[model samples]
Target: MTEEIEQFETVLGFQIPEPLRTVHNVHRWTRLGNSDEESIRSIIARYIEYRRAIGTDDLDLLRTFRNNGNVECIIQYLRQSIRPMVVNTLDNSVVLICQPGGTDFHALASLFTSRQLIMFYAMLGEYFFQQVITQEEISGRESGVTIVYDLENFKITDYLNPYSPIMQIFRIGIALLQEYYLELLRNLLVINSGPIVRVFLQLAKVILLPKAFEKIRIISSSNMKERLLELVSSAALPSAYGGCWTEVDVENVNPLTCCTIRRPIEGKAPPCNIEAAEHVNLSAGKSYSAKISATKGQTLRWIVKTSGKTEFAVTLYDSKGKGEAELLIPRLTIATPLPDKVPEVGSVECKDTGVYGLEFRNVNSSFFSLKIRYGWVLE
Candidate 1:
């Protein structure tokens, strides 16, 4: 070991100076079974100070040693001879509380080179690679430097490159640690546990992506509005829909008054059925040029054709139900129509609003179906 000490300076390209040499001698004596517990503990204290001087932590150094296996035997001797006494053996397992913020896997691994701890180092690597590296090619099962739990389950990541022999050695070492730990780690000390949990949770969110997007696309504003209109139209059919307007209040004013018919009866028919279907919506804004003819006893009927069932009203000028010019039609003028003038329907903005509901007369009676056409400037 002393002969190897001379070569250490040559390999490291720096002389093993005073305090460092003293610490290393004490460290070697313990490994060689020549030092007492007190002397080894003193060496640990001095080694800690030396580490602080170099501005590195245990975790950092361990990772570095793992990357470069040059000091493996020396580090292994330290782990076997000194590290066990330094640990805090808890009820469940050992807890290595790094000095406040001074503890790191690299430094710890560099100091203690036990197989159990080496496997843990691999796990720690796996955990960090899973968290920090999102690139898919770099995070695969066959990746060179790997972290393995069981045979099948492992996180293999690329450390550097295929050309670099240093990286190759590091990868082999990590793989060896993984294989060795599988056989040795009977009681698992959690390695990279936090980041692993986080990765799995993030994967769960990605798995649920399609369903989330479907909900968004279906319920968007434009689609929702169209869906609403379709539903309203479907539910608006006569057998289903009671009426367009709800009767709120009714008021009776005068008995009779002078009334005049306004607007032309513009009509239409749907594409298919023409039997009980000839519908018409009367344009209520303009006066209709209608030709009215009547007789005595041989009842006169002025039929208004429409597309569907509709509500219409009629009013007579200075006449009541049984007056001189009384309305004696098919159903005797349905409801109370406007007296003097009819409410305008077609406007500039909307399509049309006149007398809307019109249909074919079911009975083939010789009632002259008055087909009047009128137009208005849609406002």
Candidate 2:
């Protein structure tokens, strides 16, 4: 192996992808979040989070994925699968809709390995995030990404088998979309939701997040098109549903093999820390707060802004309310670029494992409403 590859394995505890062997290639993928060197413990914590998000307890499989630990195979089918992906013309959200009867489930499953399916998770993972978040007219008023699972002709055998690849892929997709891809998933709209889909979703609530599923829209097949058009544009739906793109054959895996078939919902959410969000409005001299509790080596990240006026300064405070914060950030006075209520965002590593407070101070004399979203790294 090359020295650079060896370095990647040693430092990140994984090999660099074949494409990212050179310094230039490393910098390319590194541009996202673009952090400096981190501790091994930090890397371990992140990997653990990924594993939980994908509903996988297989430590070895988690460690030895496609190219290495971080990067996975950049398969063409992933990008080519236009059936599930559509950009919302209204909110500009990425709509990953599942078309029932559109793709052959069994054949689709036969196309890729269980590893690659998860790699599809890793490859396209965080892939659309930067593009999704940055196109902000105003940072605070960001658009949302949505997943529309259209189970129009889905039968019980489709997802009943717990071991099916579709179920496996579904598990990974739902968990990761819920856990790692926080705040971005504005809604998980389920169109063409018949009794089965409804019951499936209800059962899924146990294995998945009740809150995330709360964002689901279980509409009838007849109303699916009209309802979706209200939120998304015709562009986001399949041509059969009045969009430009043609609906492809439903290609997925339906594992006929199964155990006791009486189960309603199949799996459960992976055990891990969750990202949180809340909406806040403040008046002049008033303040709002969101806090992240981090250990000695963990990191705390926060983003906040007011809708009416961007007159806000978000500061960090240690558990002790006595003085200024101990951690460091790039900016103290996070400003919204003129005309845009762009949020002031920053991340600071904790010096100690204590509950830290994030105070969104509204120095403005007038009242303003703001949304505060935050989370911290923990294992």
Candidate 3:
């Protein structure tokens, strides 16, 4: 592998980036039939060129994003709007499932330009890759992931139109995945496939590498559960896919919110540390507020679960009253707890020293009060 890496750099006329020089990645290249000098050189060259084109060549920048919690920040923002993609992990494989019908593409396009969305996707992919590699190091084994694409309700029109936002973003995302993470793909299971899915596969054949394309399997809804069980255990697979796992909220699915990290980095803070758990009775047409002092650079994390859907927001006020209070997280509707009892969780990094107000409002017209159990921590 060391000799192959040296030859790869010699052929490319420049040394590969430090992040791509990992033993796992070198083995991935070799496993993907890049052992020959010419093949290895060609694959590495294309990967480097793609990273440069996408402005993600600076792996250090991605590391910064991961360390500063920017990756989770972007994920939270996306979850509030659209949630077509959900990620989970099995024994040695990460599963990424996409449901095209779950997204509001028009709203997504209005919220973010194509470039912004593409960049976010790239960053998320990089984070996932990092996590997978870290797990490999810990387990002393190679790892890859499965992509389960559920096209049960996908609209062919939205995908076929060249000018559509969905089409534009989809094409770019596919290209990026193929160029950058093709070696990480164990197999792609297209479940609930139909005629439209077949058409899409035809298009994918053109975009995906021959070996990558061969990893795809189309499965109908009837036998999807049985077939998937062969690869993923009932404990790890979501119930929606014919498994026993029901922790994820399928109705309001978001990978960041639904999935738990298999192996959290040892030194970093957990996503949220609850310092207090208290209940509040919010009367109908009224609100409840909790205040906490936070300094700049500290992260404020909270989890709220109510008897019913409620309005929630966060505001930052000047500790000395020298300036007006700023709304950190705007008022948004928080859905009621799912059947699995997963609470809605959120966090934001403080940019100024101030008093942060976490407010919950009962918007229901009923005269009864809403019972809420909430927890928060500042770290």
Candidate 4:
């Protein structure tokens, strides 16, 4: 009995508790009895139906069976028709019977841990039972395991087949549910800044800004002289109008635009052409500004096209250091149409926070007049 119980445990991954083992031994003894096997089969069929009446479908459970009212009557009939025979099988052999008493039946449920894992198993078990009950064409011959076990002959004969239509339907239902939930979780993990921004802007339109345009807050502060140009000049491959407010993933190289509002330095005058030179040669420690009107979120870009061996350092601010702050000039260099590489964006921690501002430095030589053109974007 112990060996047989262990074999069942190996296959099911669960141990057969005490009283249940005793029931199994009794059932085995009855099977090997001298009377015809038909009587035993009839009792089993009646018990199965009684169990089905309540909520359970376990073929092994003979009493306290389903809540259905018919099981008690069946049990009474069995008691009268065939005396309850308890068999004692070989030491290592097993006999299937009904266990009337068991300690800690509820404790066995602990094997199922998480809610999600429990639901998964329940779905599979339900599918299996439903299939076996509904399918008509599935035959015992096609199913590998013989359904009924005949102890007298020590053989199992054809009884139930697992390939029924019921099982197939169950599988299909489970597959569909899995796919639906997986897709939902996938969408949640991916961040879509574009749509999120659009929704925010639309909501702001109705609540904050309405009827033409009123005084609004623009993040521009020149209070801090230290300038940091977050975005540098790069290939302006994107078309002017169509590319506004679009995002460029940091992992890749792309041109980002920024807007600068500037005024003349205390003593210095405006550049000569304002378009061609692309380079600025100003006295060290001087300040300058140009009239700027840019929507927030737009990137500002400066292209340098200067001749001679001179480097220019420029600073950008909102209102001469009074409002929100930004970094305009990240580094000092003579390179124009800035290289494809860009400094890391700003962050809250400091390493590379995306704020753009001005940088200060001296020029090696001086030029008569410098030309500058600036563009901004709201992305």
State which candidate has the highest lDDT: 3
Candidates' TM-scores? Answer: 0.16, 0.42, 0.53, 0.17
What lDDT does candidate 2 reach at residue 366? 60
lDDT of candidate 3 over 129-201, digit per residue (tens): 7656765766766777766777666665565565454455556656666656778888788877666876878
Number of backbone clashes in candidate 2: 14
* Tens digits of lDDT, candidate 4, 1-379: 5676565445434444333233342233234232344544443333333234223444322222222232322222111111111111111111111111212212212221112122332332333223322221232111000011111211111111223222222233333333211111101101112223334234324432231112211112241111111110112111121223222442221223211111211221112222232234445433334323443455444333322112233333433446644333222222221211111111111222233433323333443333333322223
Could you arrange the candidates by TM-score from highest to lowest? 3, 2, 4, 1
Give per-residue CA lDDT, model 2, range 1-379, as digits (tens).
3565566557665654322244432332333223445643353345444444333333232224333432332222221232223467687676654444434444434443333344455434444443354334334334556766656666645666655545644565555555445445667777655667757775577557765666766666777667777876776665555555444332321112100112122222222233435566666666665566567787665444333323222234654667655333211222222112223344566776676666655555765444444333443
Error of 2 at 195 (Å): 3.8
C-alpha lDDT (0 to 100) for residue 54 of candidate 1 = 24
Stretch of 10 with least lDDT, candidate 4: 141-150
Q: For residues 1-379, what per-residue lDDT tens digits would candidate 1 score against the true structure? A: 5566565444434455443343234334354333455544544454343333223332333235323343333222221111111111111111121111111222332232232233334433332322222212223211111111111122222212333322322333444333222211212211222334344334324432332212211122334334323322322111112212111231111111101111222322112111222223333221222222222222212233222112221212222324332211111111101101221121112122222211112121343333322222211
Clashes of each: 31, 14, 0, 46
Model 2, which residues run further than 4 Å from truth? 1-89, 100-112, 137-140, 163-169, 243-379
Local accuracy by lDDT, each model: 0.26, 0.47, 0.62, 0.26
Error of 1 at 9 (Å): 45
Report how far residue 14 has shifted in candidate 4, in Å: 70
- TM-score of predicted model 1? 0.16
